[model samples]
Target: MTDLNQAIETLSHHEEGVFPRKALETLLDNQEAVNPQLLDYLESVAIDPTGTIESWQTDFLVVALFLLAQFRDVRAYQPLIKLLNKLDSETDWILGEEGLSRILASVCDGDVTPLQALAENPEIAEYIRSEAFYALLTLVCRGQWDKSALHDYCRRMLEGGLNYEGGYLRISLTHICEMMMFSDLLETIRNCYQKWPEMSEFIRFDEVEESLQSGEADEFGLSFHRDYITDAIADLEKHACFVAGDGAEGDDLDGFDLSELFGSPDDVASEVEGFFANAETQETFVRDLPKVGRNDPCPCGSGKKFKKCCGK
Candidate 1:
């Protein structure tokens, strides 16, 4: 067999943690030298009919796709896009889509119509749709497309409320506002805050508020709900149970009968008060117990250092 064929066979069967990425990278960089072999291997991996590619092989396959995108040739575009279309919402496929996004953005060619269709397709899973939206937005930010068109899309996107769904309770529309260098959409988002108070978490209200308070911005900014103290007080009141009269001295409230357990109210009150007062002092003594260094001998009679015996 030729040397390139030998390299492909060697790479596909490489053991775990023994990836041939550097060699593959060299071949990908020199596309003219190894295009035939590299593309053949990519097609074989991408069209695995049995769906039985081993985990390690799957990792290498995605890396191969990523390297093809880095080649920045139109030839890699259609294959990557087709692979994206065939992918499902499975975790593995989601990861593959992420790799596809990099390829899509690099070879965007100033035409985002395909990406926009995917972004607006409600039939597709949000994971993939969000990736498309991000890729589209990335093109606009990179000056690959006209700003006015993307701005209009951003406005329309905000009109229906951001469709972002992921961790951290935030979305990318706020980031788009910064990237587009316009605050009109931001104002619209803030205006919606009165009706939807949760929008504050997604937008960085703290930074804006600080900026406004410092006279860094002209407007007073939107009203943010900083009612943490009020919420905390409400929680305390909910948990507070106020007995009508003295517990031990009067008829036992809540039927607990504290007198039976301890004694009369006077004795119980004195003991409890004294216990609280002395508790702090006793706690200090307990906390002041000599610190046992990790390397010091264990105090449990193990005859070993603290780290070796108890710390472990």
Candidate 2:
């Protein structure tokens, strides 16, 4: 066998971690000696019909491809694209999902055609939704595409929120919005909040608040916060309406005893007054407490430290 063929055989037979690491290092060091052999191996791995490639192998291949792409090796493009398509075809393989995401990100450096193809594939749409959403988000953020497309896509996805089979997708949409800094997407989330009020409480308003405070605002800016908060309040109002309709059946008043529920007016007033009095006392005690930091003196007045004391 030729020297290059021997190197390829040695790489294939070695364990994944060490072999890929060494082979990649060698390829980077001696490109002329190993480039053809490396390309051939990638093609074989990309077309492996048995689906026997392990997660480590997939990770190595993806990393190798990413490195090649970074070098602007035009020869790597077709093979990487083929691997991406193959990964998209194998939805049952979780490793493929990760590999495809990495590959898409790597190739997205220049040509977006592969991503567009993946986005347009119906069979892989659901499986590839998050990656596609993110890629489009990157495009919008980088001014590569018109914002209208992203807005329309987000709107369509949110419109189907009620029927979504995966909660992760819903959460991912929120993440994508945050990443893209697209405040317009807030309206879509608002529609979702209107449909499901309980979900309103779970929304991370603090992140939005922080984003706004940091001046990292993107398209639509602070309007995102205003719309989101307004929608949450509307959902809360709807919740109140439902409670009113449920009347005595509502759990809002269900946890009390008979006496608490329908007691003498004076007795109820006294109990309420006592409850508030104790609650106020507890609140005062808490409010009067000294703040402790890791470097601060202990509340016990110990000279050692807070973290070293009761704070521990």
Kindly list the per-residue Cα lDDT of model 1 for residues 124-174, writing each as its tens digit. Answer: 455555556556555654567676887787677766635543311123444
Off by over 4 Å in 1: 1-3, 10-21, 36-57, 91-100, 161-170, 191-312
lDDT of each: 0.48, 0.48
Cα lDDT tens digits for candidate 2, 258-306: 7745778998899999999889768454453544555333334222234
lDDT against true structure, model 1: 0.48
Model 1: colliding residue pairs: none
TM-score per model over all chains: 0.53, 0.48
List runs of model 2 lying over 4 Å from the truth: 1-22, 32-39, 49-60, 74-82, 85-102, 120-122, 125-127, 138-164, 193-312
